[model samples]
Target chain A: MHTSKVLVHNRDRSEIESEENYLPLNVLRLSKRFGGIHALNEVTFNIEEKSIISLIGPNGAGKTTFINVVTGTYPPEAGMIYFQGQNITGLPAHKIASLGIGRTFQLQELFLSLTVLENAMVGCHTRGRAGMFAAGLRIHPAKADEKRLREEAMENLKMIGLEQRASDSISSLPLGERKLVGMARALGMRPKLLMLDEPVAGLAAHEIENLVRLIHSLIDRGLTLFIVEHNMPFVMSISERVIVLDEGFKIAEGPPDDVRANEKVIKAYLGE
Target chain B: MKNSEIDRTHIPFIIMIAVIILLPIIIPSAYIISVMVFVAVYGVLALGMGILIGHAGLFSLAHPVWFGLGAYISGILAARGWVSPGIGIIVSAFFVALISYIIGAPILRLRGYYLACATFALLLIAQIAGGQLTNITGGHEGLLGIPPLSLGGFVFQTDLHYYFLSWALCIGCFWFCSNLIHSRVGRAIRSFHDSEIASKSMGVNIPKYKLQLFILTSVMASLAGSIFCFYLCFTVPSFFGFHLLVELLMMIVIGGIGSIQGPLIGSFVILWLRELIHIYFGKIFPVMTGEVDSIFFGILIIIVLIFMPRGLAGWVEQSFNLGRRTYAYFKGPGA
Candidate 1:
């Protein structure tokens, strides 16, 4: 085991070397309120290049709110979000996704009626360069692009070990399989930034282990990940930096060891 | 059914062409051919309704208003000789798409019963306006002496000729709609229908896709309306009435909502039932009772709903699924 602390907040020679060519990916500062409840307050976070960051909190800690605001699912009324160093506060979700960010839902939102392959192909929406009218007319270029999309979609399914099940309807799949299919669909977009909302939620322990290893493998391939999870042990083992929230306010931020030992985070979980 | 699964939509169109080709060969009745022409016309109209209500989950009630708009616009243009019949059809479909794009944006924001009410009222308003505005629509008497559709140099004069033309148009429209339903946007529409909020989070441009589909379906409806005027050589206010709108819905529900073949199948079944009811009941029942077609239609809708909530198209799919499962089970230990 590599028992080393890669302090993301601190600067080292290699870290500075990497940062010199670093492009700003995503920066968020948000405070959201609903009537008498402060759902999220003065929350600020940054996702750097090639990092796997975990957001951990108890129930109602607004972990999802943070993801929603950053991904353009929910517009934050009080603060701004910057993607790729440019302000992208209130752009539509699809526009934000087209800018290289992709996501999967907590409950696994697969197109249930469509086949697994077709569902994955929907991710190629922005990537397809050919016009729909040309495709309808079956022009040579559009036909070629469609063939390419089908092949790429199959390749993506194979990435998640679902290539054999490509023709099966999503509704025929079990819950764990559907979750994997959802991840496969997001991966089909060839996204630079992937935000997974509770990717392993409700899975069996064995399934969770498989998923964690897969995610680690993906991160090693240079994809950046921001995950919202309640699985603290997994978060501590894999995440470089852990951010803890209680009632929508950031309570602590440090290395996994520091976050795991933080008294306030311990209190927040124990109290809930 | 195995090979048919990939092109299940082509089944009804193929069956329809076969029937139309055989009808003249076997029956040789001019009146029946005219009735067959209505079936083709209704089939086209029902497909437009099916695309919106079935595939897109729009539950629109303003479909007939678009259809009527097409009829009146094309009728007025061709009747006055201001434009050729072909140009009249194009202009009519264009206005319907344009108007739906403008009005559908705000109105489609409402869902379910409220949406139904808003669109139903819209159809009612168009019907009334068409009747009241004598100068433009020709009011109660309707537009008469609309020019016949001509292709190249040949005029479509006979009922047999019109039947072939109408069915050809129906085939073209069906092909267009089936292609749309299989397109990428069609998949997005189905995803939106499954879960609107989830689709939103997944970066689907929901409102834009919804509005575009609405306009597209309206244009289809208008084209069907244009075809109707071409066949009839005249247009009447009653032809654009509310009952026809309800009938179109009935055809879609009986056939299958989202499945491409359902609309044509449902319309064929309904038209045959109506003919059967009229032949029997018109002879047996008293004049005070009107025609028994309405009652038969009501019963058919209820029976189909009770037995097949997914509609006839769904039933066809279910059977195919069962067959596939059985085949897989035999091929392996367990499927």
Candidate 2:
């Protein structure tokens, strides 16, 4: 299997060019099982570097499970995951995050008790080096690092157009605004590869359009995006490439127009 | 984005500090001074616990073990003339911190009730060790003749001096704690309390932060214990036991769980309530019987938990806002 991949790479050198530049995330035969159910079965795909890719499928089609596996929330039963040419399979969530993979939750897990700014500031955890003792002493270096983090967090909020709400409590925000805050927080991590789980699931039409535009801006800044969405129109319009899953199997993968017209994708969604 | 340099929430804290400073002058009674000293000692202990329970969202029953270790180590060293009380306090705190880190590394892996049970087991182990290690601890008979803390030539011989010392220590810990919570590290710790998974995804090392908080609180508790030993000039296993743990826990919960002022205010309220109950009910109810005081304490806790779920700090903040509104109304809108 490995030799076949190598042979294909060599043959397609003219078209694909460098492997590292072409693929930021590559999964080989990734499988996950829960008891008797196969949540993901030998799924294989590679996400292009600096491109916005979408994973869309019906509920229970293992869309979220795939994201979970990629983000290191759940270890795959078999196969390897490579991010930026490094095997990151089974690494803990925080370790994966530090390696430049950031994600937002589908249910919007904003730090509700904290201000929006503080919520984003938490994403600066990996970047800041000051520990509890240094913070307690209010040392010169720690203070400087904190000021930098605050400024950076504010910048992220501004990018998300939530700078005005930086000091507002997260609990006071509407669901759509809170979702943006989650994205802003993830962006604060300085992730090269950002995975968004159901980014437009419960958003209003206007909010969905706003998120679509924001994602485009993010991609323009040289960040790779892996998005999971059930919103077909939003996914179709925003993504350059779309992958279709059906009951733990990838039924289709191509440009949005091709995937949308694929017989397998239509049958998988229509259940005939 | 109104950049008010100072947090308005600190107004109540300023008032509290002013009240504490004026307490000794207004009363000047030896008994009152001693009561205030007890409040300060427990305030320090509870503030440490607050960082764990309130900030880090961890509950440990083993704080008394660290507290007892502090008192016993200081007491033994002072009695044997091996070290000065001041050095003993610092040494004991480091020792307890080391033990807490070593034990906490593995035990903190268990979450919620399991973590609570593991720490409770540690408390029992410490109790057993205290009873068995008679050579140093003096066992149940207790270690006596522990010298009072002195600075160079001046010894803290009076309750007044000890009162000032304990409060000074409490205030210093409070300052350090407030600085910590407002800093970047404190924000990460608070993030853990809200959602561990979210915190982890944000690149916060969950286990490392938890263990750091556990060790820090343990060291703070140990320092309070050392001061407690010097203040009493003696130590016993019973001094650091389940009752003290319960009282300290009550202080943080009743004062406000996550707020800095919560533990301090909680400590003052609990101690004052216990004293008032002991004095007034001692004659009316059976003097030796524990039922009346226990019943009253239980009722008071129930009322506070039900009425002011966020504790006294939350209640005070609400009332402070109310007071502002009333003043604004009386001063005629524009004022």
Best by DockQ: 2
Model 2, range B52-131, lDDT digits (tens) per residue?
88888888888889889888888788888898877888889889989999999999998888988999898888888898
DockQ of all candidates, in order?
Answer: 0.35, 0.75
After superposition, candidate 1 runs with Cα above 4 Å error: A1-24, A130-132, B1-19, B288-291, B323-335
TM-score of each: 0.90, 0.93
Task: Point to the candidate with the largest TM-score.
Answer: 2
Listed for each candidate, the true contacts retained, as a fraction, are 0.31, 0.73
lDDT of 2: 0.86
TM-score of chain A of 1: 0.88
lDDT of 1 by residue, B170-192 (tens): 78778766766676656667777
Q: Worst ten-residue run, lDDT, model 1 chain A?
A: A1-10
**RMSD (Å) per prediction:** 5.8, 3.2
Query: How big is the positional error of residue B196 in model 2, measured in Å on the Cα after superposition?
Result: 1.1
lDDT of 1 by residue, A168-247 (tens): 98888988889998888787677878888888878898988888888887887778888889877788887888889889
